[model samples]
Target: MDFLHSGLAAIQRHLAFVAVDPIDWKFYVQAFSWTVTLFESYLLLRQYPLYSKTSPPESLARHIGQEDFEKSQKYGKDKAQFALFSKLFSQCIDSAMLQYGFYAWCWKAAGSILGKFGYGGDYEILQSIVFSFTMYLLSSLPTLPLSVYSTFVLEERHGFNKVTPGLFISDLLKGWLIAFVLGAPFLAAFLYIFQWAGDRFVPWLMGFMISFQFIMVILYPTVIQPLFNKLTPLSDGELRSRVEGLAGKLHFPLKHLYEIDGSKRSSHSNAYFFGLPWSKHIVIFDTLMQQSKPEEVEAVLAHELGHWYYLHPTKMMAISQIHIFSILALFPAFLHAPPLLRSFDFPKAVAARPPTIVAFLLFQMILTPMEAFISIGMNAVSRHFEWEADRFACELQDRLKEESMTDMGDRLGRALITLHVKNLSTVWVDWLYSAYHHSHPTLTERLKALESFQAKRAKKE
Candidate 1:
């Protein structure tokens, strides 16, 4: 453990040291970010044998083997497969590169701005807030092209996309409008607050931001989502009643069970519990209701409810606040470094701006390991929560003694496998990959957990 800690520390120190050197900082940051993103993308893409056309079919068979071979075979060698594979690969590459590109752009932009302005105490905080928000806005731009390629080109070719060009453009316009109207004020507030309060005000500001986000979460499904998609109350007869009854039994007060027209854009299916505690609602994609059996739907809903019941969102928020405050506390040390800030040519009064931005970016680069560690911890907890939800579903099954529900679990697993394969997800992900990239445990792992639970139940019987 000590050796591992030391190695991680050394890596962070080396990255920070490189970032502080003016001559190499931009190149190093870009290279580091891009390398990490591309490597992860490669690993994810390698999971789908169809994408690696270089390998002979027999070699691919041998690699994936006999047991798991049936899973890939289910998709078959149709145009759908080709379309899905191309779309998935393209989207993955776009996602990975776009994220890194945004970071690179922001680093350069902030560096340029600060170089002209100079770094100082109050100015440093203002720059951090500005860079953070500006980068977020910039990052959103690439999503337009990505959505078009994924939905119009790839999905349309596969006969999965239902959105017309007009709808797509409208959605984009609405999204951008909302971001500008809602996001700008918050960003402005953050900058002003940081400038006024300095480092001492960071925790309070972060706390307020977290609280604000929580409020948005609560209002999103009820207020915000209606602006884009029609969310009719789920009207699938007995299934709706059963879902309501289940929620009632759990004492989960859910209002407005909605079925969003997710299939209008893509075939992917999902269910989520959104909004604040008081206004929390269960939202199921229309595609999900179309594909999944009632019991499978219940199982998925139970899983989402488990997240709320366990207060996972609140806990996640708390963890994020701690991280933000820690970063804030470290600002002064990096900001005060003359050599690091000198290259930026910031005015003495506002000299903190450039160095502060540099320091923040540099800190983020070095904080990757810490981020990975926290993500691992969170994912582990999430997996446990999933298991707990499965248990809840099983408990309900036992009381009803429903063999139908067992089949529903199997069907749910099959559906997930299909979607994952289409997405080019790593089917045989190792522990390290799961820790960093996958929040939910693998399909096979979840299935195995269910099997184990059933075996224990049978033994008790």
Candidate 2:
């Protein structure tokens, strides 16, 4: 811990010049952000051509019928077109916001609102909370129509949208309410740490963030998720029995098994498990049950369990903590830099003693290019984890010495194909586009890997 602080202090000293340098941070931010946006748009253009392909990849050809394959292609094309336009549209809105100093205006507006409530600038934490929500609400407003069109028109045409107009409105309101209910206290505590800890905020902030994630892991399933979707204990029968038996064999600490009403929003089919190390719950989407057989669903659970067994989630969390630490460690210099705030058109008085939230927000904007690259790295790591999980599922028969589980790989492959067909997920992905965007191996890639895994096991036998 002492060494960590020493390192952070060293970094702060090295970047101390940032406090006095008159860099045009705003121009750099704008240039880099637009560059990323355009590059992403280019990736979409690369991927857009693949959607015109007439059929699924040759490996997937046997699994997907011609009509279903055509549907997937059409769906992919439609989604890609929407994505291209939406990406450009959003960038334009954000670019305009930056060009006109919307962030500076937002901070002032937050102060105005805070003053109306009898709070002064001395209440920085309270003011920060107001500033956050004000920015979130106002910035999000411009993109809300895009979200609406995606859900109502685009998804509806794809025959996947299960959201009614009234339900959509209700969900939106509930989401905003939940955001306020949770976000205010979290933001207050976050800013308070900066005050309480002063320059030694990095380690403490990391601890708080990690604790919050743990809390969310508990609250999301039990409280927040239940608000959005129904989760009934999976009905007793072959599926439940199979899942329980698999869990027992793997010693997965199975606590509660649930079937979530995922079809209430969309026809997407999936399953996942989450909880602390000791107690875990598995939730399967009802749509998955409706689409695939009991055994196939069991196979899907097996693949998910593979993730748990390999500690993928924990590893991912650790990686995120490091990412956060990197961001926080470099923040103190920027936090004290008046020029950074001024570059974005903040008032000289406000910029001189910059608010923590304002500085952090600008710092993040300056990190746009870096974050874009970090996402590519994270995606690579996630895709590797997915491969390992698939392999783990393939070899489960050997791990448990269960004869009945011999065809787990085949079952998983079938489930993957069914899911892709049902969801109309893009198949024939451009390699470069996929490297940037995909967090999991494509369906054909996974199926081919599974085939090799089965073959390898057979050879060992």
Candidate 3:
């Protein structure tokens, strides 16, 4: 503890200028945020032209029918245009808000709302909660039109939207309700820890954040997900048998197998597993089952289980802890910086004693450039994990010593191709755009890698 305190103290001293310096933090934030936004827009520009191609690549031409390829190209072009427009639109709103003191106004508005209910500024946590939701609800309003257009217009045009207007509104309201229910207590606990631990909040806060993640892992499947979609146990059949057999062979603590009604809202398909280390549940989208063969689905699960075998999720969580700690460790210098808040147009009284929430929020804005770089690195690591999982699926026969699984790689490849075609996923991608945004390798990349894995395994055999 002493060593940690000393280490953190040294960091705080290095950043001590933040506390007393009269820096134009808001200007820096605007510059950094705009730089990220414009660079992303440029990447989209680089990628937009790919959608104009008249044919699929030679490798995928056999897999995708002419009609499907054209449809996917059209979908990709439409989405790219929407993305380019929405990115600029959202950035305009954000830039205007910052230029005109929206955040500072929100803090005061939250205090006023609380005052009406007999609460006062003395309740900083309550004010912070109110301020957070205020920002969330208001800031989200500007993008609601885009969301509706994407769901109803774009997706509906492409024959993927399964949502009615009524369902959409209901989902929106439920989302708000859930956010408040979960976020309020979480924010309160977060602020309380800072107040209690003072300068020593890093380790304590890291523990809390990790604990919250574990709780969410348990809650999301059992409670929160059911509210959005149904998750019935996969009916006893070949798919279930294969999945269970695979799990048992791997000695995975397979607790439950469910098929989700993902088609209830969208035609997108996926499957994943989650739970504690001792027990886990696998949920497959009904659309996935409808689209692929039993063997192909089994191969997909083999790849998913590979993620478990290699501890990808745990490694990602560890990286996230380091990210969070880095943020918290460098926070104290900003925590009391009156000028940081003042530059954002906060009133003198409010700026004099920076609220933890305000300080944290502003600090995050200051980290726009750093966060963008971190996102690229994280995506690279994620893509590497995906490659490993693909190889694992390919080599499953060797791992389990099962002759029946020798062709798992081909099955997985077919499954992935089917998924991409059904979802109208873009085939041609810009390398720079993909590095910045995509968490998985492109279909061609994965397919090529899968073939290599198969060849290597054949040589070993």
Candidate 4:
């Protein structure tokens, strides 16, 4: 308890220190820009998970037990998950646009004010207000079109979308309205804290943000997601029975399998294990059921179960919180540099606008490498978990039958290959490049691992 209290106190002190500092527009701009760019890059990389290097043609040929190149040629035809891939790609571009617009606006606004006067007095207050408003606008914009494209253009094109455009637009408007209503108080609180604690409040603000974010993470899967999609109990007889049996054997306390109408918006299939305790459930995409065989579906579920058994989500949350706290603690050191703030002509007080934009950008630039390091670490961990999941799935398959296991693995591999081909993913990716940006291990790596696991099991039998 003392340790926890001490840590909290330390974070508060750090927040306070940074909050009171006169704005440093140069540093702000640098930091914000770097952060936006890095974040965009990370998001783009996430799209890779939906694509695999092996083409559908290759996978199909392999599926029929074709070994020779001549025999494989007969099955060589490209079939891909084009709609999902296109949508994800477009979303990545949209993300870039939104981030760039926000950062550029802040940088200009803060720099303009700071160029006139150094930090102190009324200018500081003005700077805070501008910063807060800019943030709010950035957060609010881009929802309407992004959401629409996700459902209509991408999903509809692939026969996975069911939601009408009207519905999509309505949801967007409602979301924005909610944000405005609910977010105002928080924004106001932030501005007040900035003014009241001055340079001494950065740590506290950071702590507040971290704590708030943690709560949101816990609440989102249960309270937030249901607002958008219809989730129903998994009523399929064979699938449910098999999954339940697997869960029971593995000592996993799975209670219900829910089918989410993911096809209502998109064609891509997925399954996730979400929530905790009583709220915990498995959500499988309806599209997945339509597209994959039962064994393939089981394999995918096994992967999700792997995430649960390994407690990946909780681990990730803990890591993120620690990182946030650590960064907050360092706020004071930057705030103490008056010369740096003065260099950007930051103003003092609530009414005075300082060049915080520039300061934020600068800070973000310097923090890029640190962010990359953290992301790489998390990606590494994710890949390991994926491998473990594959192993678990293999074990489950073997428990059933050797031939069944092999056939299931083959079909699942083929499904991924088809999905990737449609998405136009290159078969061979640069491993080093993937290590830095990719979250999951490469498809080739996963397939090979599965194959090796099956072979080992065969030997044991």
Q: Where's the lowest-lDDT run of ten residues in candidate 4?
A: 71-80
lDDT of each: 0.60, 0.93, 0.96, 0.59
User: Candidate 4 on 103-208: residue-level lDDT in tens?
Assistant: 4456456546665676432454455545555655665464546556556654455445666768777766667665655466555665567567665565667767
User: lDDT (0-100) at residue 134 of candidate 4?
Assistant: 64
User: lDDT at 432 for candidate 1?
Assistant: 60
Model 4 error, position 52 (Å)? 15
* Segments in model 3 whose C-alpha atoms lie over 4 Å from true places: none
lDDT of 1 by residue, 396-418 (tens): 55655655555434444555554
- Please, what are the lDDT tens digits per residue for candidate 2 over residues 1-461? 89988998999999998999999998999899989999999999989889888867887788899999889889988998999899989999998999998999998998899899899889888888888998999999899999999999999998999999999999989999989999999999999999999999998999999999999999999899989999999999999999999999999999999999999999988999999999999999999999999999999999999999999999999998889989998999999999999999999999999999999999999999999999999999999999999999999999999999999999999999999999998888998899999999898789989999999999998
Q: Rank the candidates by TM-score, best first.
A: 3, 2, 1, 4
Residue 341 alpha-carbon offset, candidate 1, angstroms: 5.0
Please write out the lDDT profile of model 3 over residues 316-430, one tens digit for every residue: 9999889999999999999989999999999999999999999999999999999999999999999999999999998888888999998999999999999999999999999
For model 4, the superposed segments whose C-alpha errors exceed 4 Å read: 1-134, 138-163, 181-218, 277-279, 335-346, 350-366, 397-428
C-alpha RMSD of each candidate structure in angstroms = 7.6, 0.8, 0.7, 8.0
Per lDDT, the best of the predicted structures is: 3
**Candidate 4, RMSD to the unseen true structure:** 8.0
Displacement of residue 72 (Cα, Å) in model 1 is: 5.8
Query: Of models 2 and 4, which has the larger lDDT?
Result: 2
What lDDT is obtained when candidate 3 is compared to the true structure? Answer: 0.96
